[model samples]
Target: MELIVLDTAEAIASRAADAIEALLASKPNAILGTATGSSPLPLYDELTRRYEAGRISFAQVEGFMLDEYVGLPEGHPERYATFMERNLRSRVDMRPGSLHGPDALSEDLQAACDAYEAAMAAAGYCDLQILGIGADGHIGFNEPGGPLDSTTHIDELTEQTRRDNARFFDGDIDAVPTRCITQGLGTIMKARKLVLIATGENKAEAVAHLVEGEIDPRWPATVMQNHPDALVLVDPAAASLLRQRH
Candidate 1:
C-alpha cells in the first residue's frame, strides 16, 4: 500500500490521472473500474481534459461502475448510470457497449448480481480501479461489518450512507435509496491496481482508518492492505488524521 498526500485536490487528480495515462499507454483496451461521488470528480475532469486535448483516448477502453442504487427510476438524474453518463462516458470516447453497471431495477435482482459478476469475468478483471472511501469507511456500498470476502451482491444502505447521499436528492433523506447492488471486497481485490482518493476533513477519520488501522471487515477499505498494489491519494484535510505522511 502506498499513501500520497497532496496539498490540493488538483494535485491529487493530476497524480492519479498520470497513473491512468500510463496504464492506457501500456494497454489501450484496459478495463477501468470507476467510482462515483465528489471524491473522483476532479480525476474525471482531468481525464476529460486529456481526452479533449488528444493526449488520451478511451475509445478502446471498457469501464465498470462500483455500485448502483436499487429502484432508481431509469432516467433519475441521481442514478449511478446517469451520474456516469453526465460525468464521464458522455464526455469521453468510450464505447457505449463497453461500460456496465449492476442492474438496479431488475425484477430478479439476484440473477442480475450474478450476471454482473459474469460480465466482469468475461471482460477480464479490472486493470485499474478508482475508489472513494465513505465517511464511515465503506467502499462500493460495502458498509461496516460486511463480509470481507463477499462477491457481487445486494447491500442494505446504512443510515449514515443514506444521510450522506441525501444532498444529491435535494436534501431529502427519504428520497435516497436504502438499498444498492455493489461489487464486494473480494471483487474489488481482484483488480490489478487500486487507486483510492479522498478529500476534505469529513473523510479524515475514514482515511486514517484505511491507512493506519487494522485489517478488519468493520472498515471495508482496510482490506486494501492485503492488495498487492494499492495507492491512496488524499488532500491535506483528508490526511490530517494519519499518524505518518508520505
Candidate 2:
C-alpha cells in the first residue's frame, strides 16, 4: 500500500487525476473501474477538462461502475447510474460500448449479478480501479461482515451508510435504498492498480484503521493492503490519524 497526503481536497484530486492520465496515456484503451461519490468529483472534473482540451480522449476507454443502489430506477436522480452519467459519461466522448452496473428491477437479481461479472471478464478485466472509502470502512458497499463476497451481488446497507448517503436524497434517509449492488472485494482486487480517494475529517478514522491496522473484515478497506498496487490519495483532514507518513 502507498499513501499520498495532499494539503487540500483540490490538490488530492489534481494529483489523482494526473496519475490516472498517466495510466491512460500508457494504455489508451484501459479498462477503468470507477466509483461514484463526492471524493471522486474533482478527479472526474479534471478528466473532463483534459478531454475537452483534446489532451485525452475516452473514445476507446471502457469502464465498469463499482456499485449501484439496487432499488432505484435506472433514471433515478440518486442512483449511481445517474450520478455517473451526469458526472462522467456526459462529460467525456465515450464509444458506443456500455458502462455497466446492476439492473435495479431485474427479474433475476443473481443473473444480473452474474452478467455484470461476465461483462467485466469479457472486457479483459479492469486495469485501474478508482475507489472511495465509507466511514465504516466499507469498500464498494462490502460492509463489516464474516467474509467478503467474491462476485457481483446485492448488499444490505448498514444504517451508518444510509445516514452518510442521505445527503444525496435531500436529507431524507428514507429515500435512500436499503440495498445496493456492489462489486465484491475479490473482484476489485483483480485490477492491476487501485486508487482510493478519501477526503474530509469524517473519513479520517476509517483511513487510519485501514492503513494502519491489521487485516480484518471489520474494516473492509483494510483488504486493500493485500492488493499488488494500492494507492491511497487523501487530503490532510482524512490522513489526520496516520501514525507515520512515507
Candidate 3:
C-alpha cells in the first residue's frame, strides 16, 4: 500500500484523473470499477473536463459500480445508477451497454447478486478500481465485521452508515435504504489496481485505520493493506491521524 497526501480534495482528484487518463491511454478497453459518493465526484468531474477537451475518451471503456442501494425506486435520485448517470456516464463518451451495476431492486436479491458476479466474470473483471472509505471504515457496503473473503452479496447497512448517508435524503434517515448489494473484499481484491481516496477531517479515523491499523475484518478497508497494488490518496484533513507523512 502506498499513501499519497495532497493539500486539497481537488488536487487528489486531479492526480487520480491523471492516473486514469494514463491507464485508458494505454488500454482503451480497460474495465473501470467506480464508487459513488462525494469522494469520487471530483475525480469524475476532472475526467468529464478532460473528455470535453478531447484529452481523454471513455468510448471503449467499460465500468462497474462498486455497490448499489436496495429497495430504491428505479428513478430515485439517491439510487446508485442514477448517481452514476448524473455524475459520470452522461458526462463522457462511454459506450452504451458498457456500464453495469448490481440489481438493487430485485425481489430475488440473491439471484441479482449471482447475475452481477457472472456478468463481471464475463466482462473479464476490473482492471482498475476506485474506492472511498466510509467514516466507519467500510468499503463498498461491506460494513464492520463483514467477511474479509466474501463475494458480491447483500448487506444490511449499519446505523452509522445510514446516518452518514442521510444527508443525501434530505437528512431523513428513514428515507435511506437499510440494505445494499456490494462487491465483497475478495471481489475487490481481484482488480489489478486499487485507488482509494478520502477527504475531510471526518474521515481521519477511518483513513488512519485503513493505513495504520491491523489487518482486521472489523475495519473492512484494512484488507487493502494486503492488496498488491493499492494506492491511498487523502487530503490533509483526512490524513491528520497518520503518524507517517508521504
lDDT of 3 by residue, 86-137 (tens): 9999889987667899998888999999999888888888999999999999
The lDDT for every candidate, in the order shown, is: 0.94, 0.87, 0.93
What's each prediction's TM-score?
0.99, 0.97, 0.98
**Which residue pairs show collisions in model 2?**
none
Total backbone collisions, model 2: 0
Q: For residues 120-177, could you state the per-residue lDDT of candidate 1 as single tens digits?
A: 8888889999999999999999999989998999999999999999999999999999
Poorly placed runs, candidate 1 (over 4 Å):
none
Superposed model 3: Cα runs more than 4 Å off: none
- Tens-place lDDT per residue, model 2, 1-246, is 989998987788788788778887899888999899888999999899989998888888888999888888768887888888889988899764456676757878888889888988888779999999999999898888837546788789999999999998999999999988888888888889999999999999999998999988899999889888999999888888889875
Model with the higher lDDT, candidate 1 or 2: 1
Model number with the top lDDT:
1
Clash counts per candidate, in order, are: 0, 0, 0
**Residue 194 in model 1: shift from native, Å?**
0.4
lDDT of 1 at 220: 91
